[model samples]
Target: MVSDTLKAVMQKEGVVAIVAQGKAFPHVVNTWHSYVSVGNDSFIVPVGGMHGMEEALNHDNRVLVTVGSKEVEGLHGMGTGFLLSGHAKMISDGEEYALMKKNYPWARAIMNITILNAIQTV
Candidate 1:
């Protein structure tokens, strides 16, 4: 689930890393915090491009995402972050994709992530 503070962090400009499993090494992709749309237990990403995402998802749909913003107030300072664990799937057409496309006209797909766990580290 998403918290109020975390939602605030998402609204600010920041880096978001999406880590996925591959056959040899773990694959990592970067997206902006502003690119993420948060729900109660889900997050939808308008995928402009993520080269190995589909291939990696084919092996394992599980994903780890790290999102943070220095502009948001944290537990100790002016930075806040969360590590999110979820299952992801890429969809090219659907209501979700349509919604995402409305926001990001350049998006080629939608990565719908269902959150399994979310931990605040700062």
Candidate 2:
């Protein structure tokens, strides 16, 4: 499940990175997303991207996401950010897919990332 703090930060900062494991290095794609809760400890984030996102997922299901804001200042003028690591399943069907399609009509594919860990400093 997504913690209230993380969810709040995500809501405040709607954009995040979907980083997938690559052969040489991690492939990162920035995207706008909508956060969803499937159940306890089962959080989902739907993202829209071109071929890279889909291709990366094909290579490895494990992914990492970095969220939060760089412009927002904290107590000590530090940037607020969060890192979410987890596994994701590529979805082209079902309600989540449909919703993603509806939200992002030009999206090539929709990735439903199940967040395993969420760390935030905001």
Which has the greatest lDDT? 1
Candidate 2 residue lDDT tens string, 1-122: 57654655555646767788776678887755344434445545455544666677778889887777555554356557777788877766787667756756865455667777877656
Residue 100 C-alpha lDDT in model 1: 88
List where candidate 1 sits over 4 angstroms from the true fold: none
Candidate 2, which segments miss by more than 4 Å at Cα? Answer: 33-48, 70-79
lDDT of 1: 0.89
Q: Report lDDT (CA) for all predictions.
A: 0.89, 0.65
Q: Which stretch of 10 consecutive residues in model 1 shows the poorest summed lDDT?
A: 45-54
Report per-prediction Cα RMSD to one decimal: 1.1, 3.4
Residue 59 Cα positional deviation in candidate 1, in Å, after optimal superposition: 0.5
Q: Please, what are the lDDT tens digits per residue for candidate 1 over residues 1-122? A: 88888899889988889889987889898888788898998888888778687789889999999998888889999998999999999999988899889989999998988989989899
